[model samples]
Target chain A: MRLPPILVYVLRRLAIGLVVLFGISAVAFSMAYLLPSDPVTSRYPDITNEQRAEMRRQMGLDQPLVVQYARYMESVFRGEFGRSFGTGNSVVQDLAQRIPATLELASFGIAFGVLVGIPLGLVAAVRRGKPTDHLVRVVNIAIQSVPAFWLGVVLIFLLYFQWRLVPSPIGRLSPMFISPPPVTGFLTIDALLAGKPDIAFAALRQLMLPALVLGLGVVSPLARITRSAMGESLGEDYVTFGRALGLRPRQVVLGDAFRGALVPIVTTLGFVVANVLAGAAIVETVFAWPGIGRYAVTAITTSDMAPVSTCILLIASSVAVTNLIVDLSYALIDPRIRHEYAR
Target chain B: MGEKLFEIQNLSIDTRRGGVTRRIVENMNLAVERGQIYGLVGESGSGKSISMMASVGLAAPGLLVRSGEVGFGGRRLPASDQKGLRGNLSHGVSLLFQNAKGALSPFLTTGRQVERVLAQRKVPKPARPKEITELFRLVGLNFADLGEKYPHQISGGQAQRVAMACAMASNPALLIADEPTTALDVTTERELLRFLTRICRERDMAIVLIAHNLSLVSEYCSGLSIMHAGQVVEEGALRSIFATPLHPYTKGLIAAVPDVDEPHELVPLEGSVWGGRNDIVRCRFSHRCPHVRARCEAGLPPAIARGGHQVHCVLYEGEAA
Candidate 1:
C-alpha cells in the first residue's frame, strides 16, 4: 500500500517533531539535574542525611542517571509527570488545571494581534508612503519597543486605577461570580456552555488587559512582516496585470495581492502564537493570571525539576507543532510547494 | 488599413526623486489602426513600456503622466486622469506582460484566472464555464488538463497562453503586449508572436507589441516606432522603415542585429540609453549618433515628416523622402 505524498510529508514532520521533543526533554532533564540546589535538599532543608537518602530512594532519584531517565520516560509515556513540590500535587494534574487559562489568554492575544495587525499592514502597504502608512509604522515601532510587563502595568494603571474603564487586573473572573464547570477548560467557553453570560463576560473583561499587552508585543512583527510581504506582492506583475485587465481595485488587491502575501503572513502568525504561548510569563504574573507561564516561572524559581522540565517540554512541543502546522499550511497556500511535496 | 482604434498623443512622463525631476518619456505619439500589429521597439529603459503603460493609466507609482491624451474608441481622456481612463477604457484595453507566470495570480488556477476576467466583464454565471472552456481552447489549451493547475504547475509557454486567454476574455479592441515572449524560448517566442498576429487579424483587434529586438518587430509588426532615450527617433510603415532607414539610431539598431544569410560584423550601439542630463532639452540620441553634428546638441530636434514617415534628426531637417 502506498501513502499519499501529503500524508507522507505529515508523517515525516511528526516524526521529526517527536525527535525534537525527545531532545528537548533530555536537555531539560540534564539542566535540571545539574542545578546547584538539589530538589530533595531544597524541598526539605532541615532533614537529616539519612532521611534525605531515604527520600531520594523513594523518589527514584537515587538511581543512576540513565536509570532515572529511563524511569522518567516510562512514567511520561504513562501520563505521569511526578509531583510539584510547591503544590504537592501531580505535575500532570497541576498542568491540566492551569493549561486552560493560558490557552484562553493566548488565544485572545493572538486574535487581537491578527485582527489589528493584518489590516494595519494592508493599509500601510496600500497607502505606502502616505501619512497613514507613516502613522501605522511609527505606532508599531512604539508598541514593539515597550516591554510587555511595563505595557501591561501601564494599561492597568490607566484603565483600572485612573479611569475605572475596565475590570480590575485581578484574575480571570471577579469575586462576585464563580467559575463555571471546567468543560473544555476555557472559562469563557465553559461559562457560555453552562449558559452563564455574565461570568463569560466577566472572564473576557479580565482577559482584555493581559491579552492586549501580549497582543501589543505580537503586533509589531506581524504587521511588519505583513507590510513588507504585502508591499512586495502588490508590486508583482500579477497585480499590474489584474488591474490592467480592469478588475475592480478591491478584487485586485484582496484576491490577487493578499493571496500572494498569505504564505509569509501565516508563517509569522504561527511563530507569534508559539511565542505568546511560551513566553506569556511576565504578562501572566502582572495580571495574577493562573496560567502555565506563571506556573513555569514559579517552578523554575523553586527549582522543582519535574514541573520545570515538563514546562520546557510543553514549550518545545508547542513550537515544533506550530512549525509543522505552518509548513503544512504552505502546501495549501502555494501550488509550488504542493507540487514539490507531491513529487 | 482600418480606422484608428487607439491613439496616444503628446505623452510625456516624468520621475521625481529627491527633488530632481527626470523626463522618462517625452512627447510620444502612437496610433494603432484596427487589426494592425504596431511595434514600439526600443532598448531596455528607452521608455517604450513606460509610455505604453502610462497611456493606459497603469504607470508605476513614482512615474507622473506630465501631459498626454489617450484617444480610444473615439473617446478622448487625459492621461493624468488615471481613474477616469481606467473606468472608461477598461473594457476596450487589456494588457499582456513579459513575465506571463509572474503576471498570473499564483494562487488561482488557470481556469479560475480566466473565469475571473470573464466575471469582471459581467458574463453571466451560467455561461462562464463554457466561455472559459472556449477561451482555453482558443488559446490552444486543454481545459481538462491545464485549467485547474496553478501558474507554477504549468510551463512558461503554457502560462503565456493562459495570460493570452485572460487578455482575450474581455474581447478587447486593443491588447498592449509588453515583451510578452521575452521570458520564453526562441521557438515559443516565434509561436506566441505568430499566435498574436493571427489573433489580431482574426479579431480585427489592434496590438501594441513592445519589444527591444528589432528583428522580432521587423518580422511581426505592420508599423513600427524606434524609441531611444525617451523619444521616438523614427516611426513609419515597417517596410519603409526597414527599406529606407532614415534615423541614425534606427540604422544602428538594424545593424546591431545578426543576420544568418547576410552575415556581417554586428555594429554594437556605443553608449547606453541613459542620456546624461535631463535639463538640456536636446536630441536624446545625439551622444550615440555616428554622424552627430554640433547642431544636434542645440535643442530638441523637430519631427521631420515626409509622406507617412517621420524622423527626429538634424540630418533629416531638410531632406526630402
Candidate 2:
C-alpha cells in the first residue's frame, strides 16, 4: 500500500521545520548564555556576590553549559520558556498575551499589501509603457522606499495631530474602555465575539496606521513581482493560444495569464509575510503597540535574556509554519508542482 | 479548386523597435479556398507566420497592421477591428501554431482545454463531455488516459494532436497552421501532417499551412505563396511552381531541399533577408536574388502573370509563357 504523495511531503516538511526550530532555539540560547550581562545581576543589582552565586545555584545557571542546555530543553519540552527577570512573569505567559497583537497587525498588513498590490500589478502590466504603468511604478517605488517608522510618525502627525481625523494612538484601546476577555487573544475578534462593536472599532482604529505603514512598505515588491510575472505570463505562447481561440481578453488575462503568473507571486508572499511579522517590531515600538515585537524590544533593552530568546524561538516557529503552508498551497494551486510530491 | 473562403490583400504590418519604425510585412496577399491546403513558406523572418497571425489577429505584440483587408466567410474585415476579427474568426478560423507543447496552457488538463474551447463556442452542456471524448478519439488519443493529463504529461506528438482536437472543437472552416510540426521528431511530424491532411479532406476545411520546410509544404499544400523579406516572391499551384520555378529566390528555396533519390550538394541561398527596409522602393527580394540587375533596385516589380501562376521579378517583365 502506498501513501498519498502530498501527505508524505507534508510530513517531510514538518520534520524539517522541527529541526529548524530546534537549531534556532539552541543558537539563541547559546548566544544569550555567552552574553556578558548575567540575568541574576540584571534582576538583582543591589545583591552581594555571595547572594548572586546562591541565586545562580538555585536557578541552575551555575551548572556546566551542556547541563544548562539540557535543562533548558527540558523546560522548553514542558512548554515552559522560563521567567522574564525584568517583569517577573513566565516568558510563555507574556508571549501568549502579546503574540495575538503581532499576528493581527502582520495579518492586516500583509492582507492590505496583497489586496492592493496584485490588482495594481495587473493594471501596470496590461498598460505597460503607458502613463498608467509609469504612475503605478513610481507610486510602488515611493511606498517601498519610505521607512515604516517614519511613515508611521508622519501619518500620526497628519491624521491624529493636525487634522484630528483619528483617535490618539495611545494603545490598542482607550483608557475609557477595558479590553474584552481573551478568547483567541486577538482583540478585534475577541471584542466582536463579546458583542462589543465599540471596543472592536476602537482597537481597529488604533491598528490602522501601523498596519498601513507596514503594508505600504511591502506593496512595492508585491506589485513589481506581480507586474513582471504577469508581463512574462502574458508573453507566453499559451496566452497567445488563448487569444487565438477567440476567448475574451478578460478571460485570457484573468483566467490563463493570471494563474500562470501566480506561482511566483505565491512564492514571494511567503517572504513578504515573514518580513511583515519580523518587521512588526520597529512599527510596534514606534506606535507603542502592546505586541510581542514591542515586548521583545523591551526585553532586549533591559537585557532580559529568557524573554528575548523565547521571542526568537516563537518567530522562527511562525516563519517555519508560514513556509510549510506556502509550500503546501503551491502544490494545491498548481498541479505541475503537485507531481513533485509523488513518491 | 474549391470556392474562395478566406483572403488577405495588401496586408502590411509595421513594428517599432528602439524608437525606429520599420515595416516587417508589406503588401502581402493570400487567398485560401475551401478544402484547399494553401502553404505559405518562407525562412524564419519572412512574415509567413506574421501574415497568418494578422489574419487571425494574433500577431506578436508591438506589430501594427498599417494597411490591410481580411476577407472571411464572404464578409470584408477592416484592419485593426480586433473585436470584429475575433468575433468573425472565432466560428470560422482557428490557428495551430508551432511548438504544440508551448501552445497549451500548462496548468490545464488536455481535456479541460478542449472542453473550454467547446464551451466557449457554445457547445451544449450535455454534449460537451461526449463531444470532447469523440474529438480525442478523432485525433487518435484515448479520452481516459490522456484527457486528465497536463500538457507536459503527454508526448510532443500527443500534444500536437491534442492541439488539433482543440482547434477542431469549434468546427472551424479555416485552420491556420503555423509550423505545427517544427518541434516534433520526423516521424511525429509526418504523422501530424497526415492527420492534418485527413481533416482537410474529410471536413472540407481550408488550411493555411505556414512553414519553412518546402518539401513538407510540397507534399501537403495544393497552392502556395513563397515569401521573402515581407513580400511574396512567387504564387501559384505547388506542382506548377515546382515544375517551372520563375523567381530566382524560389529556385534557391527548391535547390536547398535535400533529395534522397538524386543526391546533390545542398546549395544554400546567399545573402540574408533585410528585415527593416520600409523606405526602399525596390523589390524586397532583389538584394538576395541571383539575377539581380540595376533595374531591380529602381522600382517595385509588378506581378507577371503566367497562366494561373504569378512571379514578382524584373526578369519576368513581359513573358507570358
Interface RMSD of each: 1.2, 1.2
Tens digits of per-residue lDDT, candidate 1, A133-169, equal: 9999999989888988787888899999999999987
Give the alpha-carbon lDDT of every model.
0.89, 0.87
Q: What is the C-alpha DockQ of each candidate?
A: 0.74, 0.68
Off by over 4 Å in 2: B258-266, B275-277
State each candidate's chain A TM-score.
Answer: 0.96, 0.95
Query: Model 1 compared with the native: what TM-score?
Result: 0.95
Residue-wise C-alpha lDDT for candidate 2, range B174-274, written one tens digit per residue: 99998999999999899889988998888988889999999999999999999988889899899889988889999999999998898999999998887
Output DockQ, candidate 2. 0.68
Residue pairs with clashing backbones, model 2: none
Model 1 CAPRI rating? medium
Best by lDDT: 1
